[model samples]
Target: MTYIDQLGASAKQSAKVIATLSTATKNKILVAVAEELLKSEEEILTANAKDLELACSKGKKPAYVDRLALTSERIIAMAEGVREIATASDPIGIIDTGWLHPKGMEIIQKRVPLGVIGMIFESRPNVTIDAAALAIKAGNAIILRGGSDAIYSNTMLKNIFVRAGIAAGMPPASVQLVEQTERAHVRELISLNNYIDVIIPRGGKGLKSFIIEHATVPVIETGAGNCHLYVEKSADLEKAYAIILNAKTQRPATCNTIETLLLDYELLVAFLPIIAQKLADAGVVLAVDLTCMEILNKHKIIAEHATSADYKTEYQALKITIVAVGGVEDAINHINTYGSGHSEAILTEKMAASDLFAQEVDASSVYINASTRFTDGAEFGFGGEIGISTQKLHARGPMGLRALTTYKYIIRGNGQIR
Candidate 1:
């Protein structure tokens, strides 16, 4: 059998053993893994440095390098995140609903593992630890296939998880990383429907589209974010400025960061100059619609003219598109037309405006008077997330432990016949 085939078979076999583990046993293993991550800080950083060097050699963008780099503080945060997952209530085997049938039969629904999850992600090596920790805690096995850009960092992190888990008496192969970075391996991995129960692709639009189109295995889509922030006329300018600045500049490399800004036309002359200068001061490149461009020009600010493509793009950098809309309805229409259905927010003090925007915007997470960056699993108190699923089927927003689980029915009968 080929390498990916072997990985699938081993992961499937390991899934059986992991699925039967008690909550206490799983928690023990997770805590041990977290401790190991902290203990192996030097090794992890060393591996990350290698990947960073290669990335720089290729002349990768600063945002791309930032995603691939790791530091002592980030290592600590990863370990702490794992420990938090261990402390969460296990979703496996929890009864969802129980009832008695008309024929004196007892019926119940209980949560269970998805079994042998396949994660194909890019850049961030920390996904290695977060995905494995959540899968293990939910009593599922995971097979990780990270991008080539982070191969060294991911491999090192996987080794740490394997060592800690085995020493803690967890089943071997419970967490497997595909070291092969060949693009063909992705197609082969996704085709193993018999072994991989489901595939979760975390990357750009191209990666997500490729997996959805090619993978025969079931998928829980985590969308590419083209998030937006809308500022209504009634918004508090002070709060709006803070929210926009933080959302766009705090961490532009993340999926939740705002890529487009929709402003109420009534507030264009008043609020646009203040916010535009703030963004420009932070080295943000502005792509503006005609109305916004005119206003910025009058204020002596330089901005590029926004095109139809700019509104649809997920820049994932220090850039934002600004558009002036007639009102909330116009803003909602623009967002739904161009958004990836990820995260969206509105800055408004009027109850009616915020309510309308929240109810009408087509996104997983909608915010009012808050930064779009708050759309994170840990911030929502799930410790950490596998990914923020933008799909409507199995999951919607920030996916925590429960998102990794499925449910089964149990029926007990005493010779009841039709």
Candidate 2:
């Protein structure tokens, strides 16, 4: 049989074992896994070095290799993330709702595991640990398909997890990795919807769009962030400038980085130039609307006239497009129209406007007077995450253990005539 066929069979059997395993058992496995990660950090780093060397030799960009590389600090971070997730309340079997019918029938809507999750992601090698920990803790088995760039590192990581699981008296097959990193293998795995309960593609737009288009399995499409931050009329100038700079420049390669800034007309005259100058000093390229361009040009802040295309762009760099909106409503409309529904924030002193913006903006997380960069699973108290879900279907926000589950109706009834 093909490797895909063998993987599908193992995953199907592992799901049954995991679904019946107690939470305590899962936590034990997590603790052992964490211990293993710490013990093997040097070996993991050695494996990561090979990937880094290959990436550098292939002339891959620095940013790409940086994401592909792992260090002892990052390995410890991943291990600590596992411990945090293990401490989280078990999401499985939680009764969401219950009701009793007039005919002496009791019904319970309880959360259950998704059985087997086929997770395909890129760049970040730490996802191997995070995804495996979350899935096992939530009583689900997983099959991981990490990017070819991180293949060696992830393979070693997955081996550690399996060894830890088996040593902790858990089924090692509860976590599996696709040994084959070919594109065709991923397509084959995605096609096995009957064995794999769900397909979660966590990467950039290209991979997400490809999976959504081709995969028959139900997909949790993740990450296409053109996030925005609007500085409203009543926004504090200092706060707006600080938040904008931090959101746009702090880890600009991330999906939560602010791609656009909306400046309200009332504050445009006073606040625009000040913020523009600060950003210029920090070496941020400004794509400014006509009003902002006029203000910046007068103040000797280097900027260019922003086009409509700028609003739709997700520049994963130290660049941001600035636009002057008529009011809060216009800003909201702009975000809803062009934003990628990932993370949106507004800095405003007006409580009512902040509330309205938070409610109206269609995003996984909306912030008031806070940076959009806070829209992360760790920030949301989930420890770590696989990715942020941009779609509104199954998972809508930072995908933690709860988001990895579906519910079933656990009904109990006595023998009685209807």
Cα TM-score per model = 0.99, 0.97
Q: For candidate 2, what is the lDDT?
A: 0.89
Write one digit per residue (lDDT tens) for candidate 1, span 1-418: 9999999999999999999999999989999999999999999999999999999999999999998889999999999999999999899999999999999999999999999999999999999999999999999999999999999999999999999999997899999999989999999999998899999999988898999999999988895889999999999898888899999999999999999999999999989988999999999999999999899999999999999999999999999999999999999999999999999999988999988998999999999988989888899998789999999999989999999999999999999998
Task: List per-prediction Cα lDDT, in the order shown.
Answer: 0.94, 0.89
Q: Best by TM-score, which number?
A: 1
* Cα-based lDDT at residue 405, candidate 1: 94
| Model 2 CA deviation exceeding 4 Å by range | none
CA shift of 109, model 2, Å: 1.4
lDDT of 2 by residue, 1-418 (tens): 6798789889999899999989999999999999999999888999999889888989987567767889888998999999998899899989999999888799899999999999999978899999999999988889999999888999999999999988997785889999787799988888897799999998877888889899988888888889999988888887777899999888888899999989888887788888888887888899998888888777888997888899998887878999999888999999999999999998989999998998899999999999988888888998678789999998888998889889999778888665
lDDT of 1: 0.94
